[model samples]
Target chain A: MIRVQSEAFDAGAELNAFSTQAAGAGAVVSFTGVVRDVTGGLSGMEIEHYEGMTEKALGAIRADAMQRWELADSLVIHRFGRLEVGEVIMMVATASKHRKDAFEAAEFLMDYLKSRAPFWKKEITADGADWVASKDEDEDALSRW
Target chain B: MQVLYFAWVRERIGVPREEVETSAVTVNDLVVELRAREERYDAAFADTSALRVALDQELAEFDAPLSGVREVAFFPPMTGG
Candidate 1:
């Protein structure tokens, strides 16, 4: 499942629900990204996304992960709009019969989500707002798979 | 067709989207036409290397042909997740 929305969600509850739906899976790996306080230099974050494309991009990648890994199930939930410090920005959960598959799949999801998804993030600081640049490492990470 | 901008590109171009009538054959050709229209568009598209393009919501190359494409989007490299 892939969800793109402006509403905040409970990571704990989401993980629990994902685990339950994964059925006989023996391993579940999940990741949660939060708005870092940046030593209080950051006040908040604003996320902008392509309304029609965000969902399509996420679903395509989720399906790719399912085909690449031996996964029982997978979930991706990414939020948009104003997000305060410490707020959960996104979550990824993958369940499989082995830890290796679950772990690798989760990492793959994160890597692809960083660049392929059509969502942009701008950090709001005391001075002004700036869009986060795409990291070379993030692009390099994709060459692995 | 519709041309859309995002992030700083939208801010620079001063609008999120607009309808444009064009006969450009490729994304690069379209960029050239947009750059000719106004100073803001020229500024937003000043650096082709710093930009990314999508055709009908799918990522594509600047050299990608615009044939049969109804929507075009230009923005900086995505900073998602």
Candidate 2:
């Protein structure tokens, strides 16, 4: 499953729902990304995404992960628009028969989402608003898979 | 063709999307035409290395041929996840 919405979502509820759907799987791994105020200067973050392409890209990434791993099920929910600090921005859940497959698939989903997805984040601060630049490390992370 | 820009590229270009008529055969060729049109486009495309392009919503190289492409989008490297 893949979702791209402007409304906020409950990560815990989403995880539970995904786990329930993957009942046959013995291991379920999940990851949630929160809007962190690392510098304490961030008032909020604005996520911009291609309206038509965001879902398509996410679905492709999830499909790729499923193909590489023995995943029973997978879910990805990414929120857009204005998000305050500590708000949940996105989550990925993967269920597999083994712990390694579940964990690795979740990581793979994240790695691809970081760069391949069309979303862009802007940090709002008292000083000024600035778009977050892509990190070299994030691009390098894809080489592992 | 429909041309789109996102994030900083949109900010710099001063528009989110527009219709463009061009004889350019590649993404880079289109960039050159856009850059020649106005100061904003020139500034937005000053450094091609800082930008990424998509042909019909799929990631594409600047040198990729533009034939049959209905939509083209240009934006900075994504900061997602």
Candidate 3:
């Protein structure tokens, strides 16, 4: 499953739902990204995404993960628009018969989502706002898989 | 065809989307046409290496043919998660 929305979601509830739906899997691994206040005095973050393309890109990434790993199910939920600090930005969960598959798939999904997805984040502070630049480390992470 | 910009590219171009009519054959040619339009386009495209392009919502190379492409988007390297 893949979802791209502006509304906030409960990570715990979502995880439970995903686990319940991923029947027959022995191991499940999940990662949740939070809107942290990396800099002090930060007010909020604004996320902009290509509406038609966001879902398509996420679907492609999820499909790729499924092909690469022996999985029972997978889920990716990402939120856009204005989000305050401490909110959940996105989550990825993968289910497989073994822990190694689940862990590797989850990490692969996170790596691709960080650089391949078409979403841009802007950090808002008391002074002003600035677009978050893509880190070289993020791009370098893709070389592993 | 339709041209789209996102993030700082949109800010520089001052519009999210626009209809473009051109006889350009490839993404790079289309970019050249856009750069010739105004200073804003020139500045937005000043560093093609710092940007990325998509054709019909799928990532494409600058040398990719534009024929039959309905949408073209330009933006900086994604910072998603």
Docking class of 3: high
Clash count list over all predictions: 0, 0, 0
Segments of candidate 2 deviating more than 4 angstroms: none
lDDT score of residue A1 within candidate 1: 93
lDDT of 1 at A46: 99
> What lDDT score belongs to each candidate, Candidate 1 first?
0.95, 0.95, 0.95
Tens digits of per-residue lDDT, candidate 1, B1-81, equal 999999999999999999999999999999999999999999999999999999999999999999999999999999998
Candidate 2, position A135, lDDT: 97
The alpha-carbon RMSD values of the candidates against the true structure, listed in the order shown, are: 0.7, 0.6, 0.7
* lDDT tens digits, residue span B1-81, model 3: 999999999999999999999999999999999999999999999999999999999988999999999999999999888
Model 1, A1-145: lDDT tens digits are: 9988899999999999999988799999999999998667999999999988899899999999999999999999999999999999999999999999999999999999999999899999999999988999998999999
Residue A101 displacement (Å), model 1: 0.5
TM-score of each model, paired residue for residue: 0.99, 0.99, 0.99
Residue pairs that clash (backbone atoms under 3 angstroms), model 3? none
Which 10-residue window of candidate 1 chain A scores lowest in summed lDDT?
A35-44
DockQ of each model vs. true complex: 0.92, 0.91, 0.92
Angstrom error of the Cα, residue A92, model 1: value is 0.3
